[model samples]
Target: MRFLLLILLFCFQSIQLSAQTNNYSISFDNAVHHEAVISATFKDISTDTLTLRMSRTSPGRYALHEFAKNVYNFTAFDSKGNSLKITRENPYEWKVSGHDGQVNIKYTLFANRGDGTYSQIDETHAHLNIPATFMYAPTLNERPIDVNFSIREDLGWKVATQLPHVKGNTYSAPNLYYFMDSPTELSNHKVREINIDGQTVKFALHDPGTEDEADTYFEKVKKVVIAEKEVFGALPKFDYGLYTFLACYIPNASGDGMEHRNSTILTSTRTLANGGMEGNIGTVSHEFFHSWNVERIRPKTLEPFNFEEANMSGELWFAEGFTSYYTNLILCRVGLISPEKYVEGLTGTFNYVWNSPARQFFNPIEMSYQAPFVDAATSVDPVNRENTFISYYSYGSVLGLALDLSLREKGLNLDDYMKHVWKTYGKTEKPYTIENLNQSLNQYAGEEFGHNFFNNYIHKSDMPKYNELFSSVGIVLSQDDNAAYFGAAVSITDDLNGKIQSNTKIGSPAYKAGLDKDDVITSINGKPFPNGIQFEAFVKKFKPNDMLSVTYLSDGQEKNTEVILESDPSYAISLQEKNGDKLSKKVLKERKDWLKIE
Candidate 1:
């Protein structure tokens, strides 16, 4: 019986090893042209022709980048270096014919944009978001990937990636899912290694910053890592064996950060060398939290990410929003942010979510779906994003904050619930639904409380009981009735104009008076408006329905109109310190445990 068990295990291992055979090689010989040359070879051709596809979108990003649009001069050749006949099936597909049992496909990718979504190459370095840089044969998407970075003799470029290294400049991935998820950088970057509770963390900065500030910057990031480790109870068993932080803090580089299985791409236009360590903390902390949330605690709708089409999901509220909520919380707990500053940040979130009219139109789950259009996706036409779409990031974070307080009152905490969910879905790479999340919350807390909380706050447009929940944490969610009022947002474009930047909200006095986004506010009540604040202050002196004569520009023509002033929106939260007696011992304890150091 023991011999049979061993034999079975050996067979399974053999099958796994034989399945990983995808090979890829990329060279930066054409980097000066803002292009990189990629060649992929696959043996054991099962057909006379192979269909290759360039991804239209990337994982972790919801927009369709149309990566194929950046590919030029694509060609395929046989093992003997014979040119193969190719057909353009569509914008995203290339049909290659006349390949021998082995095929080598090559293409030049023009990448000038720098962000989390696209590939950018130059004489200095090559920054690749995998899907934007590589094309895969359709049937081989499930196969393992082996990559070799062909070195330039004089460039002194070194590879920084989370893909497991098989040899020098050669890395291996378990499958295309993992391959496409790994972003790579090739440059003569500086390397710093730090030991964080036994984990070897590599920080690869593309441009060498001041050694002193770099150390301080990384130490702040180290604290965030430790705080999040306590939330999940343990760091994930990274497939690459260690973690990498690919930092690009150089002038002209766009600011962005993207998460992956075992590494993150941190790019910034500003460098930490010149006292920019403070700015680096918030963003790095957010992406690091994604090391657990979106990357591992998989969302069912987004699990098998569609590179060919737009990928939309309803769990971004938790995936991104909850991570955002914890971003600052973790920073504060680590002493990077003062307690007062942290509370001020929290107060800002409450004010935005509570006062913004967008919340009335879209709930968190509803806003999550808007990611397909709003999250890094571009459109050729104008959009009314300001008054319609509320970001799930802000909405979900506020909900997360409220839910945390509510759970704590019931003798449970959100950290406990998250740990439970991590054990069930995240660690296994098993994608989950909103229902799965609700059930988990119910299991941790009472079903009635969990169901009501989710339905009222997440599923519906109704907000949570913030005033009640905040008291338990020794915080006050206060509103001032006497706060001044205005119904429109005005922006100064130049000396000649202060434009009404947003189409007046429905029922707003400006909306009733027919003011729109491009209308230039030339003057107020027949006098020069001068600035937005002075105009707003002049209007604030009146009550709702009070009238004023306004002058503006429409489509390059001058006009005059009368706009009534309306009362400010009803809900706003201002965080104020509580009196000594109001903050009970129980409230103090709750606040301590909620933001306590790990």
Candidate 2:
């Protein structure tokens, strides 16, 4: 009965930011401890009892991470600075009673992982993903929030995020959704701002590399931003008056990139001097393109993201996969990667989607729905994921390739389709459905093309006509079915015991060598196979008809097997130019224009 007061108070504060009612302030000590002390004070109270919750799932992540698992030592106080009774309602919610009109809550956050999905804090910096760091009351969800980071000034840490900065270390967000969607990075980082046609885009860098390296990388990023803007015809008018790219290239940081409303978090363990820029730029391109595709042109199913449950959508193929295609396309158009590299990347996607047996069972939409289980989701039991599922990103990119080539053949291309969708659905904050996308395809192209494309490629498990489509642009599509075969998929768990655990396919080289499942591989050709990676790397050097000796342990008994490796049936995709095929003037013209070249 007493908890009801807190719920009521939360409701009252959820309205709007007025008279400091919905205001929130948090402070943390920048120390190199696994645990960080966080004090969150909720101001302008309404009820006596207060309730707060930690998020279970974050935006862009389809999996439920149970972020509450990291929070501990929660306590509450009142306006008179008196202690209050706090109760653990559930795994995610906390209930407090006997509080005054206001509440001052302090808790400990245990964060070690650093990526787009999780939060991490240390002596150097703190990557606070709001969902993993801050707790919000259910009633106060709609209310505005003001965040102030009180850090160690001697450490030289400043804030970089899309949240509207009011003054000093204070920031303002319209609601909890926007607040949580903004990923904040704190470090004594270099700030580089560039103006793209009057729109301010800033880059906050946490790199230990040379200034020249940083400049060269961000210059390419500027080009990517401009090229993507050309695709959308304009940028999303950021409510914060600017957009930001928070990039952390520290060796201790994890490699990840997550998209946000008007910013992105690009973290990698590679320093700038290592030439990690090229690969990381793909992440930058992909996440930035999402600022248009998924941020504004959001799907109705995902607009109001539920932080407590898995968020599913059928639009990711276009949302993520088409963005995957554009990630590479933008890089290629900006001349960051060679045309051959660009083609190789697409061919890799093509080979993955087409060669995987999963395509026979799932289409792009079904694949998108499975994101909750596969996208960063962990599983304890071993299952054959490779045989049953194809990543929507892979299939969607391949679909983008086939469809773009198809459209180009008809004198209509993906750029036109993208522009049409942006104008129709993206510009007005109108959520889109698959039917809407198909309708746009129908309106721009012929109705028959849309029907066949969606029905055969998206809804059904049938490979698109890649050969004919590529032929229109003079890029011949051929396959090499007879290629060097590596045995069954190498299953490697990041653990100490280096063993062959999976049931290798019958008659394969490893199987023929009498290397049974669960056999602890001791050595290969006198080289220690202490880990799966070393073994795989050694095997990659072997070709068809190669002879080898493998040593392993079965039932704790050592054994040696002499085996002859054989070729596995596979296909290779190469461009017509690479294969010395004819490139007509039409093909050259289509390629140049499609790549945004004169």
Best lDDT goes to which candidate? 1
Residue range 320-433, candidate 1, lDDT tens digits: 999989999998888998766787678667766766778778788889999989877878998877678778888889888988988898899999899999999989878899
- lDDT by residue for model 2 over 455-566, one digit each (tens)? 9888887887777877666666765333445465545445544577566655567767777668776666787664635545556566778777777678989998876777
Worst 10 residues of 1 by lDDT: 572-581
lDDT of 1 at 200: 74
Off by over 4 Å in 2: 1-16, 44-48, 484-487, 490-569
Q: What is the lDDT of every predicted structure here?
A: 0.81, 0.81
User: 510 in model 2: Cα distance from truth in Å?
Assistant: 8.7
